[model samples]
Target: MNLFHFSDEGSIDVFLPRVKENRKELPPVVWAIDEEHEFTFFFPRSCPRIVYTRSDEMSDEDRRAFFGATQANIVVTVETGWYERIKRSTVYRYRMPAETFELFDTIAGYYISPRTIVPLAVEPYGNLIDRLIARGVEVRFTPNLHPLREAILNSTLTDFGIHKFDNAARA
Candidate 1:
């Protein structure tokens, strides 16, 4: 399986194992995403986003409530304040050696490694909105993520991810 790491930096010689401030409880590790869920990182590093997908086990009622009439299997929501940044930002996609990583969160397509990692290659990615749309992903822009956060948590959206919420706008 192909694994990747996304960054805003144009050039990266190597990726070192490190603990994020929010993840200090865990050991330092390199993070990578599998090809299937790379869409999760198609934004600036600190851009808060909520991503949800239609699961195979989803009930029609839950699907209708969460997905509405949209045919998109995946929905990604970001605050409106980040819209301009999302458009102007250029993120680099770094291919990683799958052998050095192990599955971390299967649902999120996340992988972790205790050892340092060197990217196999790096490629610049732009047109974030178009890329997401081309992949049949519905991208949403909201003023605040607070309400949506609570709704998703209480709803049947099991296949969902709330990212960098601490950086999200306050309600």
Candidate 2:
């Protein structure tokens, strides 16, 4: 299957192994689709809070506290089969249909971040190319990044936000 990941130019080539040192907890690998709901959820600052689960299922205050007010979240789609084969203890996996996935635009991919992810290549989502360019984010076509380029291209979605990976000390 073809999956997509949205990232800025700096950390596009690297995969994080764990959450930054400052944080007390670690986050699973995360990715999202380009649909409106997913885009809005991932780009928290772009729209109002989107509650995926029933409002009664979890308090609004709890949800907001769990998911920050605004975050530069990266949206990526992983090839389930490939990801499973190389799964590790630190990573956890969660899957949902497009509708459900888009609602919250969040997933727990692994218990721990992958130690290293040297992206095969990086490309810009066509729909968000103009905005990315405006933000001075390098938007280029990395055809050789993955074998499923065509499929990923077709699945590309709208813009959310840009995440810049800091390669300095973890903390």
lDDT of 1 by residue, 1-171 (tens): 999999989788988999978779989999999999999999999999999999877777888877898989999999999999999998999999999999989899999999989899999999999999999999989899999899888776679999999999988
Q: Which pairs, if any, clash in model 1?
A: none
All candidates' TM-scores? Answer: 0.95, 0.28
Model 1 TM = 0.95
What lDDT is obtained when candidate 2 is compared to the true structure?
A: 0.30
Q: Over all chains combined, what TM-score does candidate 2 have?
A: 0.28
Q: Which ten residues in a row have the lowest lDDT in candidate 2?
A: 43-52
Kindly report which residue stretches of model 1 are placed more than 4 angstroms away from their true locations once superposed. Answer: none
